[model samples]
Target: MEALVDHVKTLAKSCDAKTRREILDQLQSLCHSIESPDDTVQRISFLNLQLAGLRIGADLKLFNILSESSSPLTIDQISKNTKENAVLLGIHRTLEHSYTLYQEVDKDAFTANNVCKTLATIGAQAAIHHYFDAMGPGIQELPDLLKDTQYADPEDITNTGIQRAWKTDLSLFLWFQEQPEELSHFQHYLTMNRSGRPIFLDVYPVLEKTETNMDPERALFVDVRGGTSHDIQEWKPWHKDFIQPQTAKGAKFYYMRNIMYDWPDDKCRLNLKHLIDAMGPDSFILIDEMVLPNSGVHWQMAQLDMLMMAVLAARERTHEQWSKLLESAGLKINNIYTYADTLKDSIIEAVPL
Candidate 1:
């Protein structure tokens, strides 16, 4: 193993990007072979340290301070300029070992690295605040909430782990409305996370090809339960008509993006039923969501699935599960346009029977 690792290092110095990626895969497999139970336990137990350090660093604007500086700054200089305690700034040292966000330059000075630049961004900062301050407690209560008799399975939206942690029966959306800053940050997080990805219009381009004979006055897209239509406005600048309906009405296409995963099976069925009822014989519902794999779920997908379970009493679904849900709502899936690589999210096109 040591000789193989040395060979990999030698290749890494001159390998092409594709070969380097292959080398990384080999290295990861080799590393996994040697990993032990204690290593796993230790890694899991120290997750709080990483999050806690990030929370403190974000609160103190440490990433910005480091990223903007021309050169490395000492702890004393950083503390004096930011007006935050020097000891609290030391918390970022925890991030260096695993995240590669910061690097020590001289003996006591530090500089920002590549990942730190991302952390310094406004959207990333907002996501950090939302996760640490708004959603942290909710995540911490998972064990206790799952054990409680009243929340056994906790499938109901009102009786969720989030409700237990937050001490409110209000739905997650309603709760977000009351927390303005958190809501804004949450929106920014979504935009930042989804940035650089192609919209459904870019991927399918079916709208451009499929001739629409509907009245020009009708909405081009109906973002059901979409709040304020910010994404719609940003995505569709020329055609800005959006409809949020509670009843059946036919349109050319109905696009639902990242909404259904916040609901359980029963509620999802009801929502789909409404969309199904509103569909013309030629109408299609393009549902955007992460379809979890049957086995060996990716880390991001697994984390998101558990997050939905904890916060919304909802879940991400597999392809089979999505098919089952669509069938339950009297709809059949026509096509699934999946993004390239590891992105689990897909555009599932369905039609009413």
Candidate 2:
């Protein structure tokens, strides 16, 4: 019996005794030998399925539907209310399977559960609206452009110089200039949340200089594209005793966030000159923007740069590009604070010297 126990212990020891290198070698060999054509095909199919589900979900306003309900509803009920077919609704229901909506249900009937409630609170319907609204005009013209035979050849009249200019920066700039109301609507959507109240409410005391017995010098966040200051009330609670803008001359730091990237060099320079004329020489300008690095490629920045070009005929700037902009704006860079790892975005402090 003792010998049998000893034999059993020996077998266990042998099983546990594989060296790290040996295990790694075995794993490498197994990985090299494995072929996963089935997995590849399944992954592609899964992505396509997700895309189709999203399209159906958007069309049916599933986020908005679930928002109005306190409890989960079946696919048939959702379809009846939304006027969407049950088959498409079922696809979205399945797509939401991993969500909390699926977990609370004893059976799958597209119940509005905790996840759905959370999504509604986050204004997921409004978010979807924003997404589709941004894409609407562009998506409408694609089919017609594709069908036009005149645009088929690379060197054709439809594809060459005049066509290129119309499709490029000039056309977009003209559209924006002509469509002031539409541009204002877009700006309202983008800048609605960025108010002085939101910025200074919870975050103000920390940013204030505690050592000074004098009232904390308020930072002047000059939104260059600062449309009608609609959200100013949100900041009043936090900065209740702060000096009014008209009264506070030179006692504040100015901030321009996400403004300079939308215009050409000449226009940006003109904008900066106007800012400089308003503020004192001692006042600092803090620019919060993505400062593209001199080296190392960032795919997101590159993509955003292209979008800015398409929409505004503008591009994201590098640190050097920013310096040039500042110079053009009659301001000089005092210091630049770049967050490590996220090297694309930075806080650039400048002064009109």
Candidate 3:
């Protein structure tokens, strides 16, 4: 095992991006191999403080301050810098003790390490904000959401997890729109996380590969907004409600990303109806989202599937599933251009049937 560890360390020093991920997966598998069932339970149950601690640390600019400091900081210095009391910042200390993301020069003193510096980045902070603040509270209600539905797959967007948690009937996006800052958090989160993901345009040549009737419809692309505020209006120009796209007919493209996956088939069909109503024969509805394979699903996507269920009573669709949903919704899929080999984020182009 020592030899194996040394080998992994050697491989890690020279491994490419793909190999690094494989090593990570292998490490996880190895971790599970050594754990007893009770250890597994304890790990899951006792780790609830991780998100809260990390997010609270980020909230107080703990990572930012630590990463920027010239040397290790005592708890007193950190508390003074953050305008927060040391007792309250103990959560941040607990996080460091568990994760070792910071260098502990002495008791109650810490300095930023590589992992801590990464967390200090704007992108990482955005991710922690979205997952912990925006989604965590509602995700805790997943058991109740499942229990109330009698363990069946969820159907309605109006009665989903977030709705139940917030005690509101508005859909997730609509509810976020009503909030002052949450909507911005979600948008910033998406912007940061989209950095390395697959892009449909990289693979699909809209003109050469479209292979559709290019008549009557003038060429125009409409990008739907997930949750937009004036802060993000500059990030995108075409800001339309996702639930009610209100697009111009005869437009060449009506593109939506990561929208369909957050909906049940029935609700997705209803939402697609809006696009179909406004689509010409030459027009296409481009759904850019993950199409999970029936087998060998990545944990990232699998966890997202759970997240959709936990949050919005939605499930990420497989290829056959996507086909079935779209065909039933009155759209004929022309082609599916999958850009990412790992996560299978793809562009499913279809025309009104």
Candidate 4:
């Protein structure tokens, strides 16, 4: 028993990302296991309200004000900074009660934690506001949507929860186009690397797989979506391709990170068909996404699956699901190199089937 305890202690202290997440998962499970039925329901129910709190906080610049201050801030001070009467201070109650995002030093007083500071950052604020703008309403509509649809799995992106809430036929991405602020925020949200997981290249031998077959006139790598700064480090000066104005007709390897889960299987198939048409004989596709397991799924994975359903009527797929989807697109999975144990972020390498 002592040895087992010592092993757990070691795992807790260690910097190994996989083990750290395992510890967190177990700790979360422990809480859920012992928690009362009332507490459990309250805990889960509050999650629905979290976006509301975050959105309200962002609008009032509450996180900004709190994060900037070195000392604890009273409600009066916060009110003064915000230039608003009777601040709701929803984030303080919602996030602190749930995630300890802020430090409630005393009654009606708060200080910034690391999480609070991140929330104050532009990207995080963008994520908070942009996501909440649609998601908050979508969540509200979801229960009715499910019941109205007779509890069917939402496979149609056209008439989704977000569309129903917003009262627009435009897809989530297209709707953002009309709102520049939200669109910029959406970009900022995409740019943020808050997941704290290893990139696909770390786990997948992408460089090794594609390096041997190089063509000078032809393109090497084309990143469709704007990638992170991490790309600058992993890929050398010659490797990065921001192919605009014209498509790279025959790229050796086309890489995308966390792109597929945004759309349903039909959309994914349609999306892939366009790409497959652009591929050369030697070309391969790399999809960086989470590959969910059949059982014992992590909460983050499960939560994201719920999120996808709520907004886009899309889903995060399991291996079997992924296989069927890709097979339908006329591509075969060469390998699935998973980079994170907790989220199971993987590089699904596919070539012509």
Candidate 5:
């Protein structure tokens, strides 16, 4: 264990990208070797507590309290400062190992780490609010929902995990419509997810490579069901004159980012058919989503796929699944462009048959 720890220290100082990858793989192996079955079971059992604590900390402004301070603060000081009860303050202290969301500098003193600083941002806080306050209870009730007859096979978005958890027949959009204030919070959550991760524009440079000399008046971008147009602004650096242009027939590419994973296969097929109808024979539909593998799944992507199941009765697709999905809609895969080293983000380019 000491040797592994020392090796990690050495690898941290090495600037080579390949060396970094080696270090991560070695660390993962070392971690598994040291971790006992009991430890693993305990961690899994306490996961719900960890998630609840994170939401609680966000609500209590615990991160903010530590972030604004010059040094680590005692739990009492934090409680006193926030005018929160001491018992409530104890929840966050236990989450020190969850993520570097918070750090325990001493036995009972705490401070914010870089990850915790992100929670201090307005957008992240809004996301926390939407997730915990609006969506949490329903997510927690997923097991009971699965047992219920009405939601036994929640394939449709209307009769989904969210509906079962919330004990409502209303779809997610309709629920948000009734609670307009929640609508903005939910929209903010979407923005936080879209902006916090990798930018798809950078992954596909073809937009800039091809759009530079094209006619400005011709529609180069169409944001179908685009909310707030944040992505359009991000795309503008590549094509400055992109102004919600016309038909998918004339457009070189039809782009959909982080959209398909929210719905099941049927809904995805329906949406794909629309994109196929809009496309010319040569035009492509670019889907930005995680494409999972058949085996040795990465934990983050796997958890996300599971959460999609629990929350929306949806899933992240595998390459074979994506190919089949596209084929069902009369589309064929042209090429897949992956960003970073993870399966969490990829661009699936498909053309109408």
Candidate 6:
């Protein structure tokens, strides 16, 4: 662990600015692994308390307590003015002790820090109002999940509590599909590095604009299980534009994103045969999806494999599994491009014979 930390520190100091940020992000994941159970529990408790405090502060208009004060105000003063219990109000002050807004001097006596003065100027109530508004159902689920440890399935973990809150109540996933601005925010959560450059913003455009760069005599791209929506339009405008052409002739390519993982060998073969019948022998088919590694046991990959099993009775495939799928489909895997940072995710190029 020490060696890993030292290696990350060295990489952070030696790498370029973007590489350094990426390294630091990975280091944060490592830190999460190293934290003691007790420490993790304490941090979760503190966060829940802080969230609760933020919620109550907004409701009682206690955020305005600092605004009304010329300097930092005591819990007694706030309780008396707001008509709330002094003890309960002190809990909020204690929860935010690390933040600059509220500083505890000697038991129950408080003073305004820099953040407090700023909050006062902006109206602390309004400052936290939006956060409280956005945190509705999902925020409440965290405390319960932290308390219950027996539920270990990643799918259940992904489906319940905070994940479900984001999925169902917030409609965050659907919102990203509908809104370009939201899609940008979602992209930040994925791996963005490529050979050393940010490939997402660079190489993505080439894959997207296949029609514009097409040759009239040849097929540019193919979508294998390409249905009504390719599901790539949220971040790839070229994909959205490419699929709309009236015909495959003239600088067009067949594009398939997230299509090959749904079936057993025989069914996948049938799907590919239909695609091959439609495409010219020279045309290329692009498949974007998870291509599991042949070696190494990744817990995340295993969990995702199980998700496919439970939901669709399908499984995530290794490269060998993918090879079989391609052969069965009457297509040959030309090249597999795995993005630099994301494990098991790849873009596969296949051609019909």
Best by TM-score, which number?
A: 1
If ranked by TM-score, best first, what sequence of candidates would result?
1, 3, 4, 5, 2, 6
Candidate 6 residue 142 Cα shift, in angstroms, is 18
Q: In order, what is each prediction's RMSD in angstroms?
A: 4.0, 12.3, 3.7, 4.5, 4.5, 9.9
Cα deviation in Å at residue 2, candidate 6? 16
Higher-lDDT candidate among 2 and 3?
3
Report model 2's TM-score to 2 decimal places. Answer: 0.55
Of 2 and 3, the candidate ranking higher by TM-score? 3
Estimate the TM-score for candidate 6.
0.44
lDDT of 1 at 310: 82
By lDDT, the best candidate is 3
- Indicate the worst ten consecutive residues by lDDT in candidate 3: 228-237
TM-score per candidate, chains pooled: 0.85, 0.55, 0.84, 0.82, 0.81, 0.44
Local lDDT at 351 for model 1:
88
Clash statistics: count for each candidate: 0, 4, 0, 0, 0, 12
lDDT of 5 by residue, 1-353 (tens): 79967877786787564467557766777777898999778867887676677777777888888888999999899899878887756755666445568788887788888878888876788877787777777678777767775555457667656776667888776788887877787787777776745556667767544745356665465555454356456554232111233244456566776668877888878777766666654466778778787777777688778777776778888888899988987888887887745554787888876
Q: Please write out the lDDT profile of model 3 over residues 244-265, one tens digit for every residue.
A: 8556676677778777887788
Question: Can you write out model 4's per-residue Cα lDDT over 1-353, one digit (the tens) per residue?
Answer: 79988888787887676778778778788879999999999987888577777777788888888888989988788888887674454435545546677888888788998788889988898888766775678777888989989999998887678888889999887787887887887777867754454766677765686666676777777665454545434443233322233255678777776667888888778767766888898888888889999887777889889989988899988998899999999999998898776688888889889
Model 1, span 218-313: residue lDDT tens: 545666645544445653523212233344366667777778888888888877777777777677888977877778666667888888888888
lDDT of 2 by residue, 226-251 (tens): 43334333433122111123223453
What 10-residue stretch in candidate 1 is worst by lDDT? 237-246
Clashing pairs in 2: 72-111, 72-112, 197-234, 197-235
Question: For residue 254, what is the lDDT in candidate 6?
Answer: 57
lDDT of 2 at 312: 48
